[model samples]
Target: MRSGPYKIIIGLALWLITPVETFAQSILRDAETEAFLHESSDPIFRAAGLTPQSVHMYLLHENSINAFVTGGQNIFIHSGLILAADDVTEFLGVMAHETCHIACGHRLRRGEAYANAGTASILSMVLGAAAILAGGTDAGMGIMMAGQSVAQGQFLAYTRGQESEADLAGAKYLETVGINGEGMIRFFDKLRDQEILAQVRQDPYVRSHPLNRVRILQLQQAVETSPSYQKPPNPALEEKFQRLKAKLMGYLYEPRRTLRKYPPSDTSIAARYARVYAYHKSLEWDLALTEAKALVESEPQNPYFYEIMGQILFENGRVRESLPVFKQAVDLGPREPLIATAYGQAMVSLEDPDLMEKAIPILEDATRQDSGNTFAWFNLAKAYAWSGRDAEASLATAERFYSAGVPMMAVMHAQRAMESFKMGTSEWLRAQDILYVSQEAAEKLEKQRRRQERQRRLSFED
Candidate 1:
């Protein structure tokens, strides 16, 4: 499973309920979603009056067009919505709403509410609607609770008010960021319409969020009430958004669907972007390359176009060509950690030791640029080890996996630290307290996993 704080418990439960092969497929993609999440959290946090310094986001490989806050820190975005959104503004709107929950202390407030609800009332509710929301049958509820420990149902049920507040605050943040608050209204409206078209089979974001005339009116009010707002003239960033959206759409939808949705267009680059990803996904190497080459020709100065070039080349096993394309991409958007990571990887693959050395500082800079990036941490660790910096390499590798939400890696490295201390060598063990805590966490998770397995088997017998 992907290295997420919630994964250890969720993974075991999902594993029991889902067939093994299905779960494995999801686990692989979940890792990338987690990485995208780390990359995207900062702006949402900053927009919602929270600190990006410690915030973490994880993308869940759920197909439902919904999102939820599982705990105090983790915001889970559905992969479906991530792929379907029209642009980053739309994606950020979803994130900003969730961020509002964190900023306003919703998790803390939910705990208070759950306590006030008392044990029996919480259990009754959990056995009722919570079971439905969680796909837990009446009997399954007991097994589910055994793993969750806390009242997971109560936590979600009690957060309805918090979700509402988040919508309001998120809209305000969108305005602050100079995003058209209409994006929120539009997106919500789309979801509301979708629920209606599906005859309300969808979950109650529609029912709870009720897209009454008042909702859009309030969003408009928030947008107008905020200080004078105007989206900055950023064609470059907008192009990046388009490209990312296109790539995601291609990956998410069938080729025929993508072609239909993004039909060829000369005025808007969306279609061209879509074609690149669609052809690439189909493994039509010649077609994808042809489309990409044309795009680069049409937009010669657009650095994002070079990013697509680098992606195409690398993905098609042209690592040698990918390196130079990635360099051009970095020149175009040095702040983008994804492009920099790609460049660094290409350098590493070619065994250009000096280039890889150069790439380390660059990758390190990328990690610092987005301290939450697990990918950067992983790359930096590998570069360090290959360059003969064992101590820092271990620490970096541990930290990399640690930030990605995998406490196991943290615990593993913590053990390494303990070993170094035993040797009375490796100056890296100077600060071992955090490592000690990680060790305890890993043990706790192992215990939970064992407990969950017992429950699953017992339930199966029943």
Candidate 2:
């Protein structure tokens, strides 16, 4: 059975669940969704005097309304929070607030960036480490929590003072970006209503953010006084936000729920997007194809529509049929690496050596741009191996393992790669670098194992 945090599940291929004891949340990853988030959040990051590349935004497959900044430069927003937002401005507002947490350095910094590590491994740098300190479950620990354990205690909740500071800082960011602050206040006003609920019933945002009357008043003052408080909404982003929410609803919600929410009468682009995912995930391929085809007709130029159609066909044993659709998607030259990776993956899946010539360069480029994508690396390895390039295959396999946080496997593959390459060559040096990092990561994991055992013993005694 396929396992680990990086396993490619069906549907739109965004659901990557990270098992952390009893605390698990799916980390959604899609090249297109990530690109949208990066675009929307880039301004706030810039306003905070930070580069968009420095801070990464992650979407959690959580229904609770929460967005948080942790470790140093990572911001995690629950998909539920995105669905809850009334408009794009509200979504951006939450992003702006989280960026403030980073800008204000509300959490003490720890560790350095692992530039090549994949999604789950990246989270392992922060939440995974924090989960370990909390004595996280042993299940899938090797894959999900297999990186440096540098941070402690600060990811879940922030001090009231910090929350207040972030609130004030967030308003300034929206003003700096020439966006309306009404959305910020409106979003917070919704959070304020949640405080009346029982603690367990309240949203995670309320628990983590510590909303007080004074803080809300200060937030209001900071936002309302800004010159950009009444600026018009960006229509394009607003439309995209609707689609984003629709896609999340379709992917994460039950098919029945999704169809009910966006019935046949709702033939809009966003509604069709939701239905396609819902139909495909429900194993109703015909319905999915119909919806996907309609979506392509509605927006012939849109790469994402084609992407969803390709995903549906690719996942449902129609790999050959999906190729032309995926071709159209990549031909549009969408900036999303995942779409290209998916296209490359489809070609490699055919297991035809003749296709390698066409597949290899696409996979190589996708892997180079998105080295952290384990799926891309895995496909590239398979493509190389089929084409009789054992050395390249081994190197790609090493990268896949490293990206997935299985350092021992990575080290082994890296060693294999090294033996195939000449000494001091670029490939050999790359293999050597993988070996070094994997070895160091393995040692740290060994230490973590010992610490976990002690913690288990202490818990048993208690």
Candidate 3:
């Protein structure tokens, strides 16, 4: 039941501190992590009266602990925050806070305020320049100061107010969802001293989120007053969180570091998950397969375990062996677009015309379920190409590029697709949509390029 690919940020200036380029490039996508996050945040979203399916959550590749809401219903969580959380509750608390931000319309209101402030600031600057030219230095200085005050007030004061509101609302949401709100208090307490740290050393959360002793006290009081304040942690949720952390650590950390972190002595499921990835990363395919098989045996019904096994085998050119494992994973997690995509990918790898026919339908379904998955679109294109569905293949290629953030390429392929399909056909209409969006993306990229060029020229002039 995947909704769609996240709306790529592109040149959106959502965060004041984070540059548009940095924000766009820092996004990381993984099926397992996304699924886990959705599972964890679903309750908080529900409590906030938001449809969990409509809210897209993304993981930022940054190592600094941070989370923020932007672009309406999107929440971006840094990988460092996930790794740093002591338990599932802490992570859930963060999710609750971010969800509350979205539910409260904080970002939208803040964005409007900022936009208005920016307009005022520009007008003031114009007046200030006119005053200076007229030899009224005092008036110019006063006008400039007023402009700065407006910008600063909008940026800092408005955001701080929003932060406080999100904290209160988030705690209430967690309580309403039957989750302990104390986790929010504890997480803030852990970072309370961070306010005193040097800006360079401070976590992104500390910089972006205004926190204080009073705010912490307020959260504590809220938790104390809530009836669900002392709710026990769910074991299933804890296990899933641990496995997610292990998976992230294994994939992101150095192989040596991952192996050392989860040694042979640690025989837990999380340990096994980490080691499997570590072995795979180190190119020890045999060892990785052995660990993956052990995991499948331990959790026979766990689709993720089977996914790891299939991945190891498929990546090592054991397509025949990988096929059944992928199928099993899909059968267990039919609704998971990633698993279904993987199964389709395995079928495509067989390169048989008959297999391509089967792969096409599976991949089409997978892409339909999760339109943001570039890999699924890629494999779908391959299947289509093999089956001589040239127009569909071209359209799929366009979609894959679009999801991967290559707008010019997407536009080119989409145009090619347009030529292959009959006018007013569904395929032709899809290509038209892709072309329209991709052209807009191309324009955005060009504007960004011009801005960068202007900045560079100004820097050189200075």
lDDT of 1 by residue, 355-431 (tens): 76887988887776655455566778778878887766777766654444345666677566555444454435532
Show pairs that collide, candidate 1: none
Using all chains and alpha carbons, the TM-scores for the candidates as numbered come to 0.67, 0.87, 0.83
lDDT tens per residue, model 3, 8-45: 11101011111123222244555566777888789889
Q: Relative to the true structure, how large is the alpha-carbon lDDT of every model?
A: 0.57, 0.75, 0.72
Q: How many residue pairs clash in all the candidates, one count each?
A: 0, 1, 1
Clashing residue pairs in candidate 3, if any?
A: 5-372
Question: Comparing 2 and 3 by lDDT, which wins?
Answer: 2
Q: How many clashing residue pairs are found in candidate 3?
A: 1
Can you rank all candidates by TM-score, best first?
Answer: 2, 3, 1
lDDT of 3: 0.72
Query: Order of candidates by lDDT, top first?
Result: 2, 3, 1
Clashing pairs in 2: 21-137
Candidate 2 residue-wise lDDT, 329-432, digit = tens: 98876566778888988899899888777899988888777666677788899999888999999999998777666778889999999999999999999999
